[model samples]
Target: MKSTMLSMLVTLLLIYLSVCLVVFLLQRKLLYFPTPPLLHFSPPMEATKVSFENGGERLSGWVVNEGRAKALLYYGGNAENIEYNITFFKDNLPDYTIYLIAYRGYGDSTGEPTEAHLYSDALHIFDQVTAEHSQLSLLGRSLGSGVATYVATHREVDKLVLVTPFDSTANVARSVYWMFPVSLLITDKYESAKRAPNIVAKTTIIYAENDNVIPRESTERLIEAFSHRLENSILIRSADHNDISEFPEYAVRLKRALN
Candidate 1:
């Protein structure tokens, strides 16, 4: 009986270690989806194709309502194409120019996506956009929230919006893989929660009532981390993480936040 118990314990330990190794090796693949532009996609008439060079790689995207005094830069989810938002932004926020810059390895942007590269590229994109528009605001959703927080902490931002955001990628990973040591295994720790206190820009947080992708606990933690009171905290009722944007309140809340 003693021998059997010891053997079972040893087998479980090996299995746990094997799974940990696999997760460590394939973590990047799991985090970044690198979605290409959708087929039959049409660029909004007001959108002009623009590109910026960062870390020796050229990243391309669209700039709408160029020369406007107010500008908004949007950073999307890990697997998002970002083009899907061009028309919506063009229609909603006429007062400000819209920037739909793609992450490296996403859309027409070159190179692969990593936390370090994305953060650096975000700053580069911000500097490029600053040349034309002085009043700049940032909008980030899901994984991009991490990038936005990093930029907001390091740069000067007038306004900020986070949609379905998380406290950090490490926490989210731990929530999913409770059996594993996700904090140690996570390669890209987008610790937005850690940097929230330093961000002083007028901020708004839009989260789904039922966000399965990012637990409410994670989102709430980020909200509580902010140093200043949020301008708005709108919740879309009966919304999931993926379909939250589809809810009618999504665009309405976003428009209010950006404006």
Candidate 2:
């Protein structure tokens, strides 16, 4: 009977080890999906290549609508390409010159992507754009919203728009992965909540009413965090995680914020 009990214990230990190994391999897919690929320049828009020198690594992006009335710098979500977003700007917000910054490892940009690297790349783009355009606005969606918030905290700008923004990456992870220790495991913190209070610019945070990916409760925490820290701010209605920009209210809110 003792030998049988010992065998059962060994069997349970092996099963536990096997599960751990599988989780270790699949964790990356759960953490970071839709990795960037090779560049495919758009055929329609007039794209100008802008290269920023970052510690011997060259980060590249495209400036769409180079010479326009105003300039808007957009830092996109995790699974985005400059070529795809060019149409959104050209079709909807053509009044402003658009800079489509491809995060490192996304689009034509070379080098591995990390939270710190992407934030610094955005600052470099902002410096170059501010040199030319008198009126400048910053926009970010999803993951890029975190990057945008960082920029808004540091710089003086006309308007700042964060679409489907989150309070912090750790907050979201806690909501989704309550059973796991994702908050500790996640490498990219993207702690927008800690930085939102520092934004002095006119800010508009557009939260989706039906955003499944980012819990509405956490978004409320973000809004409250903003109100407690920042002075001028507004929240838009009927915006979702991906389709908030489609609503006409979004454009109206943007115009109001900028003006």
Candidate 3:
């Protein structure tokens, strides 16, 4: 009886270890869900295709209303098709040129996605647009918020808007997978809270009142990290993680912040 009990315990231990190993090895695949190149709403005739080389990788995206002195650079969610935003920007923010960035592995951009690569690409995009535009604002949603926060800390941004933001991806993962040590296992720790203090740009965070992905506590923690900058954070009362953009109030608040 004692020997059978010992064998059972040993088997369970090995199974747990194997599970942890798999999770650690394929973590990025779980974190980043890159959508296939978008077919619908390809860059409209009014927009220009912008492509640049970063570390030998070709990155591309659409630049709408390209000649304006004021611009908005957008970094989208993990699986977002950024081209969908062109019509929204064309109709509402006609005054400023908008650059919807296609993160590596998403859309036509070459190479795979990683936190370091995303940050590098974002900086390159910002620098390329800076020559044409006098003032630049940043908008990042979900996973892009981490990339946007990193850029805002390093660059001179006029305004910073984060949608469905989190304090840190590690913390968010830990909350979801409480049995594992996700903080230690996560390679792309987009710790936005850590970089918040370095950002001096006028910042606004938009969160869904009923967010089912990122916990309200996580969003609140990110808001707190901004300290005095918390004055501008807005919550869409009837929205969820992915559908916040559908709300009229969300667009109205975004226009107010960007303008």
Clashes of each: 0, 1, 0
Off by over 4 Å in 1: 1-4
171-224: candidate 2 lDDT, tens digit per residue: 887887675566656667788888877787777777778786788877777788
Residue 1, candidate 2: Cα error in Å is 12
Where is the poorest 10-residue window by lDDT in model 1?
226-235
State model 3's lDDT. Answer: 0.90
TM-scores for all candidates: the values are 0.95, 0.80, 0.96
Model 3: per-residue Cα lDDT over 88-110, one tens digit each: 88888899899986888888899
Total clashing pairs in model 3: 0
- Using TM-score as the measure, name the better of candidate 1 and candidate 3: 3
Error of 1 at 53 (Å): 1.2
Report how far residue 82 has shifted in candidate 2, in Å. 3.0
Residues forming the 10-long window of minimal summed lDDT in candidate 3 = 37-46
Candidate 2: pairs in clash: 208-239
lDDT of 1 by residue, 71-107 (tens): 9989998788888888888788888998898999998
Name the Cα RMSD for model 1.
1.5
Q: Which candidate ranks first by lDDT, i.e. highest?
A: 3
Cα displacement (Å) at residue 110, model 1: 1.4
